[model samples]
Target: METVTIETSDGMPVAGLRYTPQGRARAVVVLAAAMGVRQDFYAAFAAFLAEQGIAVLSFDYRGVGRSVPVAFRRSLRGFQADLFDWAERDYNAALLAAKAWQPDVPLLIVGHSLGGQLPGLLPDNHLVDGILTIATGSGYWRENAPQLKRFVWFMWYFAVPVYTRLFGYFPGKKVRKVGDLPKGVIYQWSRWCRNPHYVSDARGRPIRAGFEKIRVPFLSISFTDDEMMSRTNIDRLHDCYRNARMERRYIRPSDVQAARIGHFGFFRPQFRESLWRDALTWIEQRTADRNQAQSAA
Candidate 1:
């Protein structure tokens, strides 16, 4: 594992970690993180993939994690970051970095939550061979878990706006929601969660092109007990990628013999034996299939 810096198009430095296998790697996998989550959160998982002979690149979006500039970290209230910047700038930079690091390898993505959605927004998304999304779903309140509907509503209508205004940002750490988020990030996310189409309307107009260009093979995995993302939500989000050759998997805790494998539990070390190994196998098989197809052609 090596810490690396990727420079965004907008002249910001994004922090990342690159995991390399001992010998020749089968393919390269980029691990994009969830909203308000740091890059390091995916470290162990990246290491595991490296052990499986796949090179992995895990990065933090600008203004978060090790990428946060020292000046901004001292006074986070002054930071200006949003979901649009994450999609256009941060993910773009990470993709460029990955290409530069492994010029000859096929690129795949393992996106969690918001990370999954951002790739569709990038113009060069077709450069990727495949995408696997875990616990990724539309944040539309109507599609959220029924029991958490009221709480989700409150978060959008009350907590987000009020907290962002008072603190010059959303102090998510205080509420144990999603750590501290930039004002723009939380506000934009709240707006999207409230809408049915979810970011389909950008700057008051419909974005007609980006997502449709993502024709890569895709896989989505959703847990039965994930508190934030219901099956409806997962389907809604996956539908956004209109051109993907996609497959969806719904895994129950009992399937893995666990009492509960919630939204975040899949990355825990305990799951290394089951879900992690299975995921590696799936990635390998997909890569092999793609190689065979290309050779035959």
Candidate 2:
């Protein structure tokens, strides 16, 4: 594993880690993290993929983890980032960096939660051959898991607006919600969560057009017990990719012999034997398919 710096188009430095296999890699995966989740949270999974002959690049978006600038490390009150910046700038830069790093292999994205939702905003998403989304869904509050609906409603209607106004950012760490986030990000996300159309409803944004342009192979995995995303949420989000060749898998905990694999359990090291292996199989198969198609062409 090697530490890398990816400079966004706007000149912000994003911190990332590259995990390379000892032998030639069959494919390269850009491991995009969920909202407010650090890139390190996916380190073990990235390393595991490397051991299986797949190279992986994982990074933190601006205002999160290592990418947080020193001026805003103490507080994000003055930070000027929103979800759009994370998708259009940070994630796009990482994808470009991964392509430059491993030009010959198929490039895929392994997006978790919010990570999966933003690819549609990327102008260069066509550079990716495939996408594997884990625990991703539309953040429409009404479509969230039944158990979290009430709390989500409160967060969207009250807490987000009140807190963002008070602190000029969302103090998510104090509230134990997602995590500390810039005011723009939290406010924009709250708006989307309240809307059935999610990001596509963002005023003046051509978000849906971007999704419609995606024609790559897309695989989405969601757990039956995901506490934040319901079946409708998952379906609604993937439905945006109307032009993509999409495959959806909903895993029951019993199928994997686990008590419960909630919104975040899929990335736990405990799933390495079963769920992880399944993911590896899908990635490898996609890589092989892409290679065969390219050769025939």
Candidate 3:
């Protein structure tokens, strides 16, 4: 594992780690984790991907993680809401960086939750072979409210915005209570919560056009009982990707007992091998088909 930095088109540096195999690889897989987790959070996943002889690039999005250039500007009363577009630029830069580093290999993207929605915004080709997203969603926010409410996490969207306006950016140190975030982070996030376009289906909908343009083969996987929202977004994706070979898997919690997993527990010490086994199985199978085609061509 080597530390790396990918500078996006807008000049923001995305901090990440890249893992390489002993020799050349046929393809590259770029992974995005839930929320805005740093590359280190995905260390196990990257290691396994390297073992499969596939290069992996996992980075922290700007304004979060180890990425530089923090957005300190808050709206005084709130944030301007436009800086959200910068997130897209970071995604583009990450993709460009992957291609730049290994110009000859095909690329596949694997995103979790919000990370899953990003690849849809990029141009597709032989350079990008396929996409796999786990616990991902479409633009529907309404479906997630039930769980968000049950967990008292709803305060994040409903109350945190108001708090940030008065306190500037709240520090993580003072967050003795839940639902508190940095002033800029909460403000920008609240804007995203309202925009569903960045996170949901966009098939000719008045909302977002980016999703309508995602035509690559996609695999959306869901646990039978995810601690978060149900697979509404995944279901919506299955419906919208009419032209792509889209598949969904709903693995039960008992399947979890057999799998011995919890939400976000896949890479923990107890479950690491099980996760590696299952994940590599999927990557190997899907990636094998892709490799054969490139070889035939």
Question: Using lDDT as the measure, which candidate wins?
Answer: 2
Model 1 local distance difference test score: 0.85
Which regions of candidate 2 fall more than 4 Å away from where they truly are?
A: 201-206
TM-score of each: 0.96, 0.98, 0.79
Ten contiguous residues with the weakest lDDT in model 2: 199-208
Q: Order the candidate numbers by lDDT, best to worst.
A: 2, 1, 3
lDDT of each structure?
Answer: 0.85, 0.93, 0.60
Which pairs clash inside model 2? none
Question: Which residue pairs of candidate 3 clash?
Answer: 75-78, 138-200, 138-233, 139-200, 139-201, 169-183, 170-183, 224-251, 256-260
| Clash number by candidate, in order | 0, 0, 9
Candidate 2 per-residue lDDT over residues 1-297, each given as its tens digit: 999999999999999999999989999999999989999999989999999999999999999999988999889998998888999999999999999999999999999999999999997998999999999999999989999996778999989999989998999998998899999899888888877789854573335998999999899999999999999999999999999999999999999999999999999999999999999999999999999999999
lDDT of 1 by residue, 1-297 (tens): 999888888888888899999898888888999998998898899999999899999998876788778887854697988887888888877887887777777789999988887887875677788899999998889889777785888899889988889989888888888878888888888888888877755554445378778887888988999988989999988887888888899999999999998878889988999999888887987889778988899
